[model samples]
Target: MLTLTWRRGDGRCAFLAGMLALLCYISPASAEDGYDLWLRYAPVGSSKVEGYRSALGNVVAPDRTPTQRVVREELRRGLAGLLGSEPRFRASPAGDAALVLGTPASSPWLAPLRHELEGVGEEGYLLRWTRLDGRDALVIAAHRDIGVLYGVFHLLRLVQAGVSLDGLDVSEVPRIKLRLLNHWDNLDGYVERGYAGGSLWDWHTLPGWEDPRYTDYARANASLGINGTVLNNVNANALSFSPAYLRKAAALADVFRPYGVRVYLSARFSAPMELGGLATADPLDPDVRQWWREKAREIYALIPDFGGFLVKANSEGQPGPQDYGRTHADGANVLADALAPHGGVVMWRAFVYAHDVPEDRAKQAYNEFVGLDGAFRDNVVVQVKNGPIDFQPREPFHPLFGAMPRTPLMLEFQITKEYLGFATHLVYLGPLYEEVLRADTHARGAGSTVARVVDGSLESHALSGIAGVANIGDDRTWSGSHFDQANWYAFGRLAWNPYQSARDIAAEWVAMTFSPAQEVVRPVVDMMMASRETAVDYMTPLGLHHVIARGHHYGPGPWVDGGPRADWTSVYYHRADRDGIGFDRTASGSDAVSQYAADVAREFNDVERVPEPLLLWFHHVRWDRRLRSGRPLWDELVHRYTRGVRNVEAMQVTWRRLEGRVDAPRHRQVAAFLRIQRDEAQWWRDASVAYFQSINGLPLPAGEAPPPHPLAYYLSLQFPYAPGDGR
Candidate 1:
């Protein structure tokens, strides 16, 4: 009904019309909902086109395997968009430029260079500019088809970033052995703590009807060099392992296999009794061992490269080997033995806590696993959360990073915005992750960081892995919000190389996701860099942890005291009184800092040496205690809270200036989300100020306004149906 017309010069219109008539294609730049994510291969600038256009006259791709086909198709799509014309396929390098894409086994040209690709391994590729038959060309060669696909994406990334393909010499191999994303997705499509929509796996229609989103999902993960994914929630159900569900998982696996991503399942440990007709699911029992072995066999039959079980045992209400008076190592070893014959690894979650409130809730996971360090099977990786307690806004490095040297340990981080204000708050988790990774664990020496421990550099272990609790769902944006996608991207980049800088990754994401223009990238990345600290300032400043509302964790609840388990309540952790505020993990209190290495323990215990950010986490300071800022403890807390709200306002101002510059849809969405963050940050500041003032009875300091409501008014507010609340 409507004819597309451009009021540009006639020459430009004629050229564009000719291109449209010839190719009949549309660039993904028109996609406003962010369905393309960072993979949007929009047209490059004239400079990039000039540098790369003559070098991409044809492609010499000889393979026709599924993965190879995928890489070829991606190149075609990307070249067409980025270069303004797709390259032609040539059997020989007859053109002046020919991009050769293949593994050694698939192409005669690459077979000679196979010796150079020796150390790159099965998933790493070698991308370089080389001469072919007296003509300059590019070569992307790897040991396997999947590796070629990764290189193809990397090539496209360079193009999107306006990087010249000339003189490109890159050889990339993932530093971590297994980069995994643990989806807290249930069978019924409900995602636990998922800020986005339902699970990507439509369980009802899966195994029969496959959604095109699945392919894009695989492509996105593969682009980041992520090799494995756990499909269901770690708080698992036995039904996920049933024959019907296994088929559905196999379907996802089939779609992912081409992209070199393996699908894993969170296994319910008590399935021997619940699914099988066994009275006792003891690890020592021959029948119990046989049941798991059969289950592993059945899973491998359907998914040949199936990743092993992700077990959450002896924690929460989930059943485990502990139910039969067995040790955690015993629980892990049984499954490890079953998966051993099939070349699988059992990822046993260490996010466990006793129902009984110990001297300190943070000390339980350390107490449980420290005794059995050398007892776990070689194939069993003890998956430890970054913090001892939970995925709080800030906490000291977990004591177990290098505590279990004899056992292969994997670092598990939550990418979901569970405590950082769900999906609404714009908290860039790169700095948060970097903080934990760079933390000196002091396990081996002063330089022993958590990153070294996870990458197996500290322990020199053969197996090393890292996991991120995924924030992905069925939303058109992939993540709930557009900027939230940056967190996902950051996690994958860090997972591939734990030592990579978060700010650098954020800048790259900004360039690819939004634009390469310096005007837009500079402020957006600055806002992202400050976002995590801003959230921490308002939500849990001065190292305060777990003060969020009970159950839902929706808003402020510093006064929460009574619950079934005292540890579950905010009052137990905060321990605010008329005299002082904050939990005292010092010698006079819980002495929880003593669990760390001697130097770390000393630093955490010393009030003066402890970092100001975590001061309240380790010490209970009096309201009148003067901080390094020369302000009283109460005044400093108020300053931080108000500063957080003001910082959000500053971010709003930064975003508002880019309205005409950024795409209308994305710019409008981010502006709206920034408003949410500003309001909620103020709520956090006011409600927290009100609650704490009731305790310390301190008046608002100079330049600070009193809260609009009393402590009771803030306390009376409830979010009964907040998104991502665990029902």
Candidate 2:
């Protein structure tokens, strides 16, 4: 087990005492403290205040735009808390110790560096600690106010991370132009696939009284360089466009504006008839186009910087242009045209699957989208889910990543633990995000990574984006579990720079959110790093995906079948039979592997060459097939499941060692969750092995524990009202 010891007068003890004092003094009545997130610039202890005070002594912002005003205010607020004194605001960099914050247009002193900043783009910024007029100053220069806002957060992060500000020359430009957060929140408080409690936006309480949580939400997004948020669920409600609801959305837009976050709404394609009282909502109809134009004008009048509409048309029974014999592009173009004059873009989701059962579900998205390549308008972005299927615990990166070079594609990742054990499971999603981002698409060549496609580096598309379905809620800790917060943090960091490693991100987050002490940080990060794989091993190892209960996706359900739709059941995905186990995505069967690039298809198509991690996803091997590791396929599968359970047991041991390292409330919360995770892990291993072994006619390994109950009992388990199902 991991161990943590704190001696008197040591840094760990000092930091612990400081945290205790802050917790005692800080009243709970402040701004739904849950919303502030890491951006909370609460007072820091005296010992660490001197360096920040000396470095960031004064602020000099020249621009007076609303966004610029927000940048200035944030600097002042953050400095006051960290340095214990509000820095002086200067008109220019005339003072010896001033910090100049502005775009090149606002600050003439940065005119000479315009050449250097030319390639950085409108959203990029340059921060330097160079001398100005013989005075030591920090200059944050960008091409736009929003970029300056991002720079301010970056500067503050450096201070928080304890980096030396001297001789700094940091210039950063976002690879993706549109960094967005997709909330699966409905008009009602329910959030689909959301593990955290109900939605953060209290729709019942609106325009009249703006929640301070809204402002704090914006602050958190700004701190992570996330600039856009889609306010409603992809399974959209037309009522969001009602005049009353528009006012509520406008109120949120006002709060987020200061933090450089522009609000985007999920639009129901049939809103023309549902809300506008039109005879038809067809995209080809002239009246439908006119209705959208009028609606766009109405929405923009209330919120000028409105990012645009996120549409989930013709998927999962949602109405769309297809109902009227129009293509996906036809639906998006109509909306894009309406928002074009106002500089808005339509985010058209490519998560569509025909209601008709297909030979292979994984190939549906790629086939549909590849045909529509270059058919979309310049302002329309195709949003593709990280994996083709609904947020499974483990999935190969979607084939759509490299198939459509002409169309700008945005990655949609789920931060919520829909398939991974929900709020109670200690599954850190950093590695999951990294795995997808680092996947080699091989679209252009060997170097064609999914990160390049997402960031617009591969295709050179004008607009690029990466969005995470938020896990945020009314929970005091923001995310339901304390460690779950890292998923949110990891998503933002990856969205900003997809090249960042998950391990590094975890280390940084652990240091900031908890303690930076080596003993505490090291063990905590190790647990986090192993957490996701452990969940995968115990839940659905060897490329076996979507084996959860039918409705709530709670416990094991390998016997689950006969759902309203075949695709919704666990048996439909795994396809295990007495003959053998695993789906056949190879050419001999579904040929789903052909959807990938030529090289990827070649690798996946061959049984011998297919990666062991994805072996079951592509081919059905005999139970006794010999693995490269010399274990029979059945034995290896059981071993993986048992290893997963053991890993969770180890994590429990690791966490127990840190009893005094974290606060009593958070420590106990995590301990309780770990206990739940261990129980569930065992449940998963037993249930899965029991059901699969029944099909393969195999016995349990000599030392492995037999399943606790009969296969019927595990299959009979039910949870109709699980949270996040949005029933």
Q: Top lDDT: which candidate number?
A: 1
In candidate 2, how many Å is residue 646 off?
Answer: 1.3
Worst 10-residue stretch by lDDT in candidate 1? 21-30
Q: Which stretches of candidate 1 lie over 4 Å from their true place?
A: 1-30
lDDT of 2 by residue, 1-727 (tens): 9565779878899887787778776654333233345555555446667766766786778647888888888888888766678888877777455588886678877776678788778778999886677777788988888888889988877665566687899999887788899998988888888888888999888988888878878888887888999999999999999999999999999988877788999999999999989999999899999999999999999999999999998888999998989999999999999999999999999988787978778888888779999999999999999988878888988999999999999999989898888889999999999999999999999989999999888988878998999988878777888888889999998898999999988887776666656788899999999999999899988889989887888888878889578887888888888767789998899898888999999999998998888889888888889998898888989999999999999999998999887656667778998999999999999999999988889888778889989888886777777888857
Which 10-residue window in model 2 sums to the lowest lDDT?
Answer: 27-36
Give lDDT tens digits, candidate 1, residues 618-718: 99989899999999999999999999999999999999998887888788888999999999999999999999998888888999999998778898998
What does each candidate score in C-alpha RMSD? 4.7, 6.5
What's the CA error at residue 323 for candidate 2, in Å?
1.5
Q: lDDT (0-100) at residue 707 of candidate 2?
A: 92
Model 2: how far is 356 from its true place, Å? 1.5
In angstroms, the error of model 2 at 468 is 1.0
